[model samples]
Target: MISRDCLQQSSLMAYKNVYQLLGVAFIVGLASGRALKADEDASPRIGIIGGGIGGTSTAFFLRQLYGPKLTIDVFEAQKVGGRTSLIRVNGEDYEAGGTIIHKKNIIYEFQDKGMAFTTTEDMLRAMGDDLLNMTRHTMNESLQHIGLSQRFIDEFAAAAVKDNYGQTLNAHGFLGVVSLMAVEPDLWAIQDGNKRMAELLLRESKANLIKGSVNTVALIKDNLGTGSVSYELDYTKATPGSDKETSESREYDIVVVAAPLNEGSKNKISFADFPRDVVTFKQDYHKLISMFVQGKVNTTAFDVGSQNELPAEIISIAPGCFFNSLKKMTPVSPNSKPDTPLKPEEAVWRVFFNKDPTEEEINNLFVSHSDLRLVDWWAYPEYQAGADLPPFMLYDRLYYVNAVEAAASAMETALIGGRNVALLAYNQWHGHFDKIDEVQLPSPAENEETKKSEL
Candidate 1:
């Protein structure tokens, strides 16, 4: 005779197990079905643009869903990890881009069958009224409505947003919650660097990596009068040991654009022969500069008596501050060990700035420095409160992974978006309409009854 609380918990577990089994059944059904738009002997051809976390993770999920026979091609213009990169200072590397991962991030559960492939409307409905209303207000207003004191919002909350996004508390409430999560104690990062995740995902997916910049994507209609449509990608690759580039084109049954389609984007991929514009409204990206310096701290400047009195991390609430945050960093390599009780006087510090710091500003922060490196990045979107989120599905058989960035931008969110697009593409191709935009879950009592019936 279990207690009522224990029985309820058991029922919840049964419900989750039942949902997982249903998802497994759905996958088995897809496996038994014929491949969509492919010759009976061949598998579907998938082309993904950008080799960032979003693109690489999408390839990984597609491989898991479609099995080994599927052909996946990943195109990257620069480094594979995109914004997740590293910078070296004094012979040691530090995270220059995406730094931390929260404990609540669902990257490990990406293969779960209960996942839903959803659109913007579906996402709003799934969030329910309370969470949906938060998106319509600024972070300050949202937090205030939740009964938080104004001082906490102005100091700690503002500092979190400033340190994470280089923005103030006026950002969207949804992303503000994300920013606050970054400061949680459960946060951790990859051992060597976060970029390694992207590299490993690409390698595990067994995708052919195409090293080139895609310039244009055009719709190809009825090749050989088969009444089947495909996409043609025009790209340019640099010739080795020469100041020249070669142009090439390839066709694929499905295409995924993993990069941001913003007006300020460097990857100018134009859409050709489409009935309408692929992306109409203009979105701008925010610029962030990560400066790494190896030097002693100016204890006096921070109103501290000595190096031991200085904080390991400093977050600024003052608007006139030159930098957003300054932090003492550890080596990217997990094997390497630092001296016990780190000396702030002799350490590597990472300083984040919305703009480049002047020489005077650098001198004021540090008494002296031996080495310095700076990395400029078009990190994330310029988030606005009450802005409409972009659609994941751009057109038939075409998807955009970065559309999720409008709500929040992080390594975990990027992987989630990638998985969502992969599922969306697979479901749409195989006519699995039942799996898309599903907003309801069965009650615990119903699941318990079903569990007993099955037994």
Candidate 2:
């Protein structure tokens, strides 16, 4: 079925045809944005897959670059925003997976929103006395009190200090080495530890999003005579199909791919091998389950999982499992809310566990006590090993841009990477271009299969 957006596209009418149809050219005149007929022959056709930030921004910018010299259509496999996802559940418009931004993330601070979006600094400035804590004492930004109970705070702090290295050690073979490396908590860091982890996969994990699955499936060129490319999309969450079941396709003179590297790994949706980039990911990406428990009192994050129940303010650094918990907790005392006599729903005490979790073990880990009840859970793959934007031309028109192979996986980094991909495509099409380096992610047909299941 055609979408409601049909009002947006108009069948192209030639220059003289307009005057011929209207029976007047001088009157319809030079003020019209129309170009002379000779310009028509040069218009390029372009198509895109994955309507996330990368795709959307590329379209918007492409319009700016080409004006009436080109036509572009984006073929998305899911909602408009790709990995920077979003959702509405139970009437609570909360982000599920990708969320949060730092003040240093200037790229987001200046994007389409125009208004400087909220940052960690924005929250602190809003609090009058809270500002006092920040100014009155020299404090580690990560260690600031976030409405954690003294008990939780102590536990979290102690865990952070451990030399456990947090690496999974249960591997049995060559894959085991990577599985172990992939699971190391330090690898998720934006610096030296797992610097590439953030560059390749973690960036999207930091954006505000309502997470869900999405994919792009290429099909036999629908407009082969017109030199076009298209895709068969399964938006209703259908199981993927083999060659015979494929249908539909988008057409383009050039295709710039700027989505994550997707191979046929248990974690990836695309089944074919990418034509470029041959390095294999350590393992199929793993799943991440996060428990965002909203209410708790006297339980400082540092104490929740640590041996000492110190005041939250005393912890040297924040725990990795938590997402600035103070935001989840309500400021009023638990007895103050009208109907429920709410507790600290404002503190955002949370934890992330991966595929290695034994069912009984994680259940015990998330079980909320009187001081804390597990209120929310976000389960999804911990995006890893996404490859970068491929070269400008794929068979002269097919372009690939995936984000799993960067050195740091942050939202801004992905956006920058995406911009690079879009610019590369634009230049190769006609505009001034730069030499974008080529990086290849995984593909199912050309690589080993991962053991992960959809569940």
Candidate 3:
């Protein structure tokens, strides 16, 4: 009913109103999208230094605790297994590093749950979580209290730890002595190598395993204005694909130092603004030399009537001998002839020495040095008797797993440390510090039952 001009004006006003509404909706949608992006960016990131048993286990446990939503990065300078590595000699891969894996541990507990056990009370009573905190007693003191004479300890227990871990019982704490008890009569190891376990952990974790040396870890305040702080990890990447490695830095909500922090280490990491106690924790290493030579033991040297009667398992040398322990690696087959001489590759011998053996000493052991395969020097750490080991958490979000090394350094302990830190970190995130030190381990018999069921 209105005029054409009025009609046109009304249409224009409607069109202008519609355009204004569209502009407001676009602005709101853009703001909401940015807010969502900011929330996504705030997702927590975890960084683990050292890809050994501790580091890999930390990554795996963190994933289990935090679910697949969180991102974890594990940085390793050398191989993934670190000291728990392997060596190849004459087509056979030998576990040249930490080879002990106890069955009576929590890793197996969680891996295989709800298994039966004989006298769970005895197993649990012996565990006595108190053993983990028994830092007041030295290994020697504990053994003495248990009525083990010094001579027996030196000959057997001390020799076992020294030859295997490069540390004497005197240098270890009560926790380390208890860890030695974690061994089973039917101790098992992966035939290929123990390094495969590290590989498995990384694969299971779905973590980004970066091949690099972490140089520094710096604490920084979060830019999200939430009054929160985070850790900045700086490292150099030299992984596969590109020949040229580049320096990279990343911000993490949490950081875990899994490797031993020896001052003289080649890959020492500087922690900026970390606690003085944690920064000044006792860190020391033992000198160990391992050699793999191909030869048979001189049966006459030990005065054995027959090579069969010779102690092929282990030959413990006297106190002043050139080597600590010599293990015969070539197992006697049923069809093997006792009189037949073994070929160079067929006969493998492993020797552990407290000090570096001279070439002449090596030549003296083997009938021929033509098949000598690998020789390695390791600066392994010893659990100090009364060392004031650091806590699992250095700061609010910064955790440590290697601090347990001062109490004990075993594959099981490493796994436990990794799990403990993961639990502590998860609890810290969820405001549940009460669950920090919680643990549930299976008995040896339960573990046996689990193994049988799996089989």
Tell me the alpha-carbon RMSD of every candidate. 10.9, 21.1, 24.2
lDDT of 3: 0.61
| Residue lDDT tens for model 2, 1-455 | 11212111211111120011121231123123221122334556666555555555455545444554566656554455444432322222233344422222333322222111112222222222243233222212213344445443234422322111121212111112222233233221111111222222212222212122334444545454543444333222324563332333334456545455534332244523334433333223333443443333233222344322322222112323212122231111222223333333333333344323344533433334323223222221232222221232344445444431222233444444444454455545442322222222245544455424422
Per-residue lDDT of candidate 3, residues 339-404 (tens digit) = 345654336677787787877766555545435655564445666665665666666677778776
**TM-score of every prediction relative to native:** 0.84, 0.45, 0.74
Q: In terms of TM-score, which candidate is strongest?
A: 1
For each candidate, the alpha-carbon lDDT, in order, equals 0.75, 0.34, 0.61
Superposition error at 331 for model 2 (Å)? 13
The order of the candidates by lDDT, greatest first, is 1, 3, 2
TM-score winner between candidates 1 and 3: 1
**Clash totals for all models, in order?**
0, 78, 0
lDDT of 1 at 121: 40
Q: For model 1, what is the C-alpha lDDT against the true structure?
A: 0.75
**Shift in Å, residue 245, candidate 1:** 1.1
Q: Which candidate do you rate higher for TM-score, 1 or 2?
A: 1
> Which 10-residue window of candidate 3 scores lowest in summed lDDT?
11-20
TM-score-best of 2 and 3? 3
Return the clash pairs for model 3, or none.
none
The regions of model 3 sitting more than 4 angstroms off are 1-43, 106-134, 149-151, 173-184, 222-227, 239-244, 273-278, 305-307, 315-317, 330-346, 375-379, 437-455
What stretches of model 2 exceed 4 Å from their correct place?
1-42, 86-91, 102-246, 264-286, 297-341, 345-348, 356-395, 403-405, 431-455
